[model samples]
Target chain A: MFQSDEDRILTLITRKLMGEATSSELEELSLLIADNPSYEILIQSLTHIWNTSPARDEDFLEATFLAHIDRMKKNGCDFDTYEQEIEAKRPWYSSRKLLVPVFSLLAVVAAFFFWPRQASVNTPVIIAEKEIKNEISTRNGNRTRIQLLDGSTVWLNAGSKLDYGKDFGGAKREVYLTGEAFFDVAKNPEKPFIIHTNAIDVKVIGTQFNVRCYPTDKMVETSLIKGSVEVLVKNRGEKWVLRPNEKLLVENISYQPLKKERNVAEPVRARKVFVAIKPLTYQNNDSVSVEAAWVKNWLSFKDESFAEVAQKMERWFDVEFEFRNESVKELSMYGTFTSESLQQALEALEFSFGFKYAIQGKKVIIY
Target chain B: MAAYKKLFHCLFPSIQNFAFSIVKSRQLAEEIASDVLMEVWVRRLKLMEVANLRLYLFTSAKNASLKKLKQENRFSPFSLDELQVEFISDYGNPEEILNGSELEKKVQEAINELPTRCKIIYKLAKEDKLRYSEIAELLEISVKTIDNQLVIANKKIISAIKYFVRKKS
Candidate 1:
């Protein structure tokens, strides 16, 4: 883009210094400045140079001054007091104190520019207290459904234990959940309903959803069926939230936890899940059920991980499962069964996944 | 400072942001900031023609805050805890959700302190409902710059929010 030596060089330098140069322009300028100290001085001098016929020092200074004005105009920046002080030190310095006001104007512009902003007082304070005194356990053959005091609905999947609800408090609303549960919350503004799993705190005001939070699986999955919810969990320190229809699977889970997996996480000292609200597809029916299968006392799955289904199976049958080939973790199934038969469901699963099994009372074994 | 009173009120809703970061003590913050306001009245001339009083107040507030902390250091050492309140409602009051408009306003103000380019870009994209290409043309830049600006802007905003939260914690 250069034509002459001095004028072309100065023009390019001015553009580059003002941050208007494109990537290639910037690269060329950088390369030139890198090998040549004189070039760097020349560029800086452009700001100090005068722009007049034969360009006297005063005129050159005025031209440079005009360039700064135009660049700032394009940039919409005003003068600061320091610059005003400098100009005040000049023959035309009176024009510079106006610089402070202008800089103040620029500060208004900067207010619109800087990151440290004056944001309103209503930043939503996320408060979580997941202290539930109960050590809940589920049996393999039964389904448990509970209506939380907040009007949120939860269906405890079979064989899964959810430690929840002593009560809700003003600054915080929380429940410690383990294994799996489907949730339907009643909307509330003043307080947010939260579920603290071993890894995250799932939050909502009023929304219908299901969270399969068993650590046994490779991931913790949350499925939203209605309304909106925010999943706030500390990921290293930052929290996150999930919106409706979006399913989040935390894939960083340890495989051993999914093994004879008793309690997935420590039940305390974990992160919060974070999700955001987005536009949603309107529901066709207001009566949509998040726990349609288990609410009616049945273990239901149209297509879900077999291990997840097995976790439900363990809860319903109140049994422990010992898998011979840990590879059985890959198989998934979709089927629903009433509490009518944990034995039949296991028999069907054994037949489909192609594994050997034995039932020693409540414990099921496959080798 | 008298000239700033109106702007101060407008900035007041947002001052908690700077105050939280500086004071480190809410009671001391509220008190000193009020003192700062009185000082604004007492030394109006020195502050007169102060271009960005938001910046000035913030700097003054911050200096006053540092002084207060130093004074507290002259006293005893201590630690406090969360003011745990009983659940006003077992879950939460259903009525809070019904009142949605207030939350939206709060969300908007929180969006304000973003970088100017980011502010313009976000407002153009969100409020005036412009396309990226349209924004690029108006600003004479690349659409990608606008996107990057948003990421940076979101980071600053998110941190400010967390700063407020951690102050209480």
Candidate 2:
């Protein structure tokens, strides 16, 4: 029980803030504040503080959820098997319809691994005349340089795969990218080059650009360096025209259709997606854009949070990072690392950020 | 699996905040919440045996946060008098605090200055928008105790603001 009048008043204020106050209590509070002008400040200050606390911040909670999902997957929770179990109970036609696109992509990927290339075999030039689909992949902790048949050059980042059809330079120059790459296409007015990613389609006419759309990332980013590009967001019917030194970011929120009401006739629409366009960042005292710096093997970031930087480091070094301390995620970092070993990079970050990290086998835990 | 994911989404934010209030560190709070959820996911088949999932989650978050605090050597056993003094005193300059359009920031800092248990109860009431009875059930405390803690939180916030004003004068 609140014995003192001041204690009772404070309790009433708390009740009011929680929307639990009775009408009599509300009237009493108003009278108390009216009788004493200073009580007005007390109420106002408490209200402001209650409303502005970081507990009400949604961004932090969203990041927490994403981190939880990442941890669960890392622990080998077998989410795919669980998903398959649910999908198996669905109608047979529904599952069959879903397999069409997947099977086609698998066929393309299969052709890439087994087809014999005339350049590799000394037997016959007939294989060279036949149109051949080529697939180029960079394994973990490695990057590769590739020159296409049309003299275009591509620098593929680590853990990335790019596949092109047989008629690459004939009528349409198109490539499907699964991870990240920097593309420098040769000029060809008759054919429009397209870079197809899972989230968006980047169409260009012989230009240099960077596309980063990792499956684990929450957004797809495309930064143009030398020429123009029109980015078409899949199923969104939205197009973004990007000029040189421009970047487009598309948030990857998948569409979840209504299940119970399957008979309703509604046009397929993208549900509440987000996109942002901004100027590409330029590294200081250099002509190169920050987005395209990976082409030169320079790991550079400008004002990126530690969590984001950690993801990049994971792919760059092929190591697993386990964050034991959450406060370190919000720390903003900016630097350039070129050819540094994983330990050296971690050491540099530790010195700059004043956080202690321990390396055990392939896992780096920051506390 | 979608049902499990939905449950996780609905409950994680409040549980994370609850842990943060106990630990007073964002990283520890996130880790605690994630660890609790990981346990739930690993023993998902046994989840049906638990009658009250929300209370289970809150308990897990609280125990894990306290354990981590102890492990980090940051936990000091508290007394009622110590908590009262902590809730009522210790604030810095007004000139640095009372800046432009940062009244919200000042208020947030005041909330952060609250005693750990008081802050957690206030968040359960205000931020999570849980009813007093609901929070009492989750924390396994009396409803009257929840009411007293919320009042303590409001009083401490006002005291912190007054501390700034007196310093300015």
Candidate 3:
């Protein structure tokens, strides 16, 4: 046989890798490997590449579902109902919630144990169906305007995502928000627009309000520009109504991971949702409200700690910050930046706060 | 719609990546894939009668991607007779194989560098795991074309791996 015949044998081995080779082809492959010796190495190399290829990884599943849900929503198709239909039909996928996370955790632990061993069990064959919802996410230093079907306009802040189902505006208009958004809801007496966040649920009827509820932030704020919105605090079931130009700051006490004991799963401490309604701060000679400054592409903070400011800066500039000293986190700062480069912003902060910061690529190390 | 979602979750990545290999843009590939899967959903009643679901999806993705290419004025028409396989001397370095992530990336880049049709064939056979006959049936080409494309793809992958190894050394 010629060199080209050996290539043909390798192609047969490729067929074997894909479970497409016949018994005769397998026998031919074995014969070729025995004869050439080089064919064995070729098969092993190719198989290894095939098995561990990145294309086999399921990282795009979440993204694909998001995009699919967006497409489905455009067609007036309800994804939630579609999902429910699938769940109702498939008995095998019934216990997916409990089974999937456990399997994923095991897969993670197994990956750690078998990292060097190159175990084939690294990939799990679990098909978990997470609820598909339409999601729009904005990165740091970026803002977006989303116009809903109900003629409501939402100005989404940097590093925010607004998720709503296809059933939005049909019955009860509700949207799940992370980070922050300024909602200018259309007047609808029958259907009240509701915004669900980690901290509180803001229900509005023809209202314009800015809700800041970053998961990492300590407080969830609902700053009303005009009209009224009823805010319901989670875990406590306490409700507070906010008037125009009034900001309702609710302490995000529901998700206190540290309050829970290390071994215990449920938190034993009595969580309290503290509510405080205050007039919106008019800054820069009453030209801008501090809470709504971000909507105008201006970064503003009042009496916020360095840690809080660092979080805001992270979103504002899309740069990661690391405080070398813990004391650096506690330093108090109140400042507003409008159209300043990240370096200039940091320089202003450093001059006033008397701290040193070094920019290393996309990271800032503060001392 | 239910069956479409099930089939979608199962095979989306393969279809999307296959489209990506052709379009060279993730966003366009995703759009093409979404369009193809949406068509499946729209025609769910008729899909059951189709002989092969995987072949149908891959074919749809390929056509949609090609159509998108033509619209974008990036379409360069060439025949399969123009294909010339290049062979590389094997370094077969152990160091190259051990770094899984880097090697996987190099392999993906290699697959990415193949001529459009050959890349799609390689992805179908290797990534999507479609059979030679299935690929031929989907592309409406002969089994010999599939074989030739796969051979070209394999040679290119080996060449890429060796190139990475040589660059590293």
Candidate 4:
């Protein structure tokens, strides 16, 4: 196959050693090697290097072994004789206190093995009501805000508590609350919201509203900010519809029938009271930004007395406040101020009134 | 003192002789063997599951020495592989020797010197043990191409050994 003498020679020599060669060239090398042994010796050297190339690296192997030993030691697997020696000298195991654990373990074993049979035979089953999952309780002056999975947000005012659970199962999104909170609920027409307070249940859909039910207060109030709500009384079965910007204040009172009239009865006129439930309102003026002013870091005081402000400050600064004279409670203020510093806000109130006040300990002596 | 004693035991005595047999230089063998062993220590994590630790370690050293020879020979025309004298050391007992680093290396160099087609066909025919027909089927060329690679690979190795042998004689 080779054309020239040099190519033929190269092919012939390669074939002679039985190393590697083309079939035609290989036939020539065999002819050459069969005639001469010198070429065969050269090919043996090439195969020698090929025999063990994969394993020629030594230090690579040693480093590999030492690393394994180090890893085993790192795992705290060194339970050597030193630990045994320390344990053998300890005297606490034979003490009576050790018997307590043994008995306790025996009691637990007894409960697992025996108690269920006795309880199943003796006690009747009573299904208990399940509790709501999510809860929020705000501190004295802070607004606790939470966004539900449905993208609805509940802003719990100071001294308020709220409880809700997985949004809705089949019928409606229901929540129970105490104290005061404002809710901005997402509009889902298929699922309406119902809030259960101590006095009444407020139900709505696609609405923003506030519910204030202070235990000490004489009335429970619900104020609709954007949409509609219906308040239902528990025993009376009375339903009151409150519209946007309208309010409802139901007195915390016992249901009493009107006193029976004694004298001559005049013909009763067609009554408006029979048709419409009387609406309730606290402010003769409009409700302003003061509703959630605390969320914006503003202390909104509307016709708030000095005593009321002092009560708030005491909780905010973790101090006790005492007024020497009762008339300090009569000095009321109306304004909005952010507390840059606790002392500065208090000074601003004092500055507005031009009143003399002393701060000795937590007691404010205002004259 | 304890650390020094531990290191003394950890050191492989087989490396120098093994490297010497491959690269055919005592000094280069020692350096290659030690460097390979140190690197083995650095990357010991990989060989945690390896069986036959001693054989494994010495083989790594032998590879390092052979690599040094190949790299050095690439630039300068000098090779430590003097053929006839180095043969017995290169083809030492596969079973009896703790490592085959020396022999593996010489085979590699002899093949590295082979022409392209010779290297491939020889690799296919001998190392892979493919028949002429099998190699032809795989390469999809004529059996002549496969036969040419084998012939060239063998002849190149044969010539390299002859040079070494002739120089010694």
Per-model lDDT: 0.48, 0.67, 0.67, 0.51
> Which tens-of-lDDT digit does each residue in A1-367 have in candidate 4?
2235435655554333333445577556446544555444443344333332122233553464455345434644342543463367432222233333222222222211111121111121121235435676766655566665555777776667887765443356788888777788888878878899877798887788878775644456677766688888654568988866567776543222223313433322222112233233211111233444444344555566776676556544545555556665776655444443455555545434544567776555666
Q: For model 2, state the Cα shift of residue B155 in Å.
A: 64
Of the candidates shown, which would achieve the greatest TM-score relative to the real structure?
Answer: 2
The predicted structure with the larger DockQ, 2 or 3, is 2
Error of 2 at A15 (Å): 56
Deviation (Å) of A7 in candidate 4: 99
Per-residue error (Å), model 2, residue A43: 59
Point to the candidate with the largest DockQ: 2
Better model by lDDT, 1 or 4?
Answer: 4
Worst 10 residues of 1 chain A by lDDT: A47-56
Instruction: Name the runs in model 4 displaced over 4 angstroms.
Output: A1-132, A166-171, A252-287, A308-320, A356-367, B1-169
DockQ versus reference, model 1:
0.03
Candidate 4 per-residue C-alpha lDDT over B1-169 given as tens digits, one digit per residue, 9 for 90 to 100: 1211122233333445445645767677656655665554444334434443334555566457657877887333323223111221233333322234443344447766665445445654443233466446444458776657665665555555555555556
lDDT of 2 by residue, A276-356 (tens): 998787432223467887776767776789988988888888887888898889887666665567886776565445567
Candidate 1, residue B11: how far the Cα is off, in Å:
73
Ranking by TM-score: 2, 3, 4, 1
Greater-TM-score candidate between 1 and 2: 2
TM-score, candidate number 1? 0.35
